[model samples]
Target chain A: MSIIIDQLNYTYSPGTAYEKQALKDISLVIEDGEFIGLIGHTGSGKSTLIQHLNGLVKATGGSVYYNGADIYDADYNLKELRTKVGLVFQYPEHQLFETTVLKDVQFGPKNLSLTPLEVDLRAYGALKQVGIPDDLIDASPFELSGGQKRRVAIAGVLAMEPEVLILDEPTAGLDPKGRDEILDQIAKIHDERHITVILVSHSMEDVAKYVGRIIVMDHGRAVFDGAPKKVFSHYKELEGIGLAAPQVTYAVNALRERGILVKTDATTVQEAKAAVLAVWKG
Target chain B: MIRDITIGQYYPADSVLHRLDPRVKLTGTLVYIVSLFLVKNLWGYLIAALALAAVIRASKVPFGYIVKGLKAVVILLLFTVCFNLFLTSGTPVFEWKFIRITKEGLYLAFSMAVRLTLLILGSSLMTFTTTPNELTDGMESLLSPLKKLHVPVHEVAMMMSIALRFIPILLEETDKIMKAQQARGADFESGGIIKRAKAMIPILIPLFISAFRRAGDLAMAMEARCYRGGAGRTKMKPLHYHGRDAGAWITMAMFVAVIVVSRRF
Candidate 1:
């Protein structure tokens, strides 16, 4: 399902001295089956904006529409909306409370009032989708390593069979290998299931590698929203907003500035290498 | 969903109450509470109420915030008023079966409610004006004399300060944990009392584990900082009672005397 946020505004602790405007008139359209990366500094309202997609936070002004239906309409079921747009919060593994990985993964499907057999089937399918071993499903989630626990938590959301999955800093705190493994798993899931994926991250490298579209948020506003390559090309603006383009993009831009004519749009290391080689051959 | 709880919330202000020595404020609260109970008649209660209102206004804390603070003790206030109204034997003004509503009982209930309300407002005023660190510092200084009697005054104050400091951090952690669990379909909102409590297991387990982890990290951090308890520790900001603090105390004493004299009549 496509998501559209129309002139949304959010203020925290309203009518109090601590009142803060977390999101300011943000409007954006997220297409179906697209991999979108949301990048922002701390307290820039990226989290607040995404939370609005699943109805976790009601917009103080304006509305969110899921395929032309108002998400905040009285007839709309928030719980069902959440199931449709699964949100894997930052450091999601800290939420693991079930006895076994299987039970934890089954929790989401069970909430939908699915039959016991269907719950089991979906839980097993989700575990497989996330590449978790069948044998490990019976093991306690708390006993698993940090990466394993993170996978289990993601699997728990996947079991609900959400059409659009929103992950906030999924690769955070993971080692390089673990991060790559998780990102690859996410990419595979997106391709296989044709699900819309919203990845919120601070790492430009991760977004450059995986996301098709990049949305840069600064101070509760969407400063940039376009194709990843196009967004990275605005290097000066990105840097001005306390964000960096991928390292390879920065390197390619530097090379071009130094009279070495190369494609400065290359965001990945391999792409940068190829562009530099092409420049040398010319 | 649990983030909206605003009990004991500190409002950052630069009012006189906020800048006063914490020890002085703490002692002043104690003395003011004692004086509230010493008042008997309607006029005495009115004087005490006016004194409390003056203090609250001088503190520059919003009146709405004081009302919010009173919300937590609404049931207690009601109980006290009801008990004083019904249980205190006096000349009856109205009778209904065994229940007697007396003129004296009505007056007693009104005075009791005012006293309790003022007492709560006075204490809450202290918390609203003082940050947790300042309160703990004042508490340590106030309790310092008990150290000679072998009481672990510093240790207790240290514990209190740490607890207060961690309260907000823990609350934020709990909120994140709850949301994470909710994302995992741990239904915290629905179900009967037993079922809801059962649902909290997932939240509580992680929260407890994380709490223990934080405690371990804190201990290690303290050790790394060469923390050796309060044996030879000196505060960067020592407490000193000024002439203005003395003047304030004297004014409070005079206010208490006026209430005492008025009540005796």
Candidate 2:
């Protein structure tokens, strides 16, 4: 099922002195099997926007429709919506509380009111999909390394079999190898499961390498939403909001500035390399 | 959802009360609370209420803000009022079956409720006018005499300050953890008391773990700066009483005199 947000607005602490407009008049549609990157600096309301998808935060004004039904309606089942649109928070591992990794992964499906056998089966499948070996499944999640714990957390969400998975800053504070492993796992999940993936990150390079579309947020507004190259082309505007394009976009732009003929639309290292090679071959 | 707490929250203002020394405010609050309890009749309570109103206005903190702190003690206030209203024995003003309404009970309940409300307002006013740092300094200075008995006055003050500082941070952490658990379908609402308590297991375990983790990090941070039990440390800005503090003390004394005189009639 697809998700549509129309003219959404959210204000924190409404009617109080500390009131702040976090999301303003945002409208967007996410189709099935789309890998979308939501990019913004901290406090830009990207997280707030996504929270409305699962009915976590109600919009002060406007509506969010999931599968053409308003999830905020009284008749709608919020628990089912949350299960279908999984949100893995910034530090998912902090939510891991069960004694064993298997139990932690089973926590989501168990909440779905599924039978014991199906819950464990889904947990096993999610663990295997996240590449957690069977030997470590029965051990305490706290005993795992940071990356392993993160995967277990992700597996916990995956066990619910969500059609759309939203991960906020999934690779934050990880080493280079851990970052790649997470990015690869997310890509694999999207490729194999055909679930719409929404990745929220401030890192341009990571998103540029994976996501098909990018939505740039600045000061509670959707400033840009397009392909990675199209979004990177507005590097100056992005930099104004304390965000930057991928390093390859800068390299390509610098080459063009020096009167060297090359494509300035490159958003990845490989794309920049190919552009430079094409110029040299000509 | 835990963000509505107003206790220990400071409101920044540039009024006379805000400018007064923290020591004076703390002592003044103590005097005010004592005077509230000293009140025996309507006249005494009126005096205390007037004094409280004047101070709240001078402090420039909205009365509504101070009243908001009462939300935390609402259940306690209700219990006290109800117990005094029903259980205090005296001449029956009205009678119905097992329930007896006495004139004395009515007066006692009204006085107790007013006193409790004033007490909360006076104390909350002090916290509202004083920042946590200033409060800590005032507390340390006020309790320094206890050091003669080998008490760890400075350590106690530091611990109080740290505890105050962590309230907001931990509240924010709790909110985030709650949201995370909710996303995992851990239903914190819509369950019986026992079932709801069971639901909290998922949240409480992680909360405790993170709390310990944060405490460890804070300890390391303190040690990195060579912090050692608050010994041999001097204040960057030492607390000193000014003319305003003396004026405040006199005002508090006058208010106490009012309470004493009003108790007579």
Q: Model 2 over residues A1-282: C-alpha lDDT tens digits? A: 689999999998665446799999999999999999999999999999988989988899999999999988999999889999999999899989999999999999999999999999999999999889989999999999999999999999999999999999999889999999999999999999999999999889889999999999988999999999999999999999999999989999999999999989988788899999999998
TM-score of each: 0.92, 0.95
> How accurate is chain B of model 2, given as a TM-score from 0 to 1?
0.93
Question: Which 10 successive residues of model 2 chain A have the least lDDT summed?
Answer: A11-20
Cα lDDT tens digits for candidate 1, A127-180? 998888978999999889999999999999999999999999999999999999
The alpha-carbon deviation from the true structure for residue B256 of candidate 1, after best TM-score superposition, in angstroms, is 1.9
Candidate lDDT values, in order: 0.87, 0.90
* Candidate 2, superposed: residue stretches over 4 Å from native: A15-17, B94-97
Clashes of each: 0, 0
iRMSD, per candidate, in listed order: 1.8, 1.8
- The model with the greatest lDDT is 2
Docking class of 1: medium
Residues B1-265 of candidate 1: C-alpha lDDT, one tens digit per residue: 4554445557777788888888888899998899888877778878888888898898887788677767778899999999989988889988999988888889888887888888888887888888887888899889999999999998899898788667667778888877766665567778899999888787788889888888999999999999988899988888888887887888878987898899777
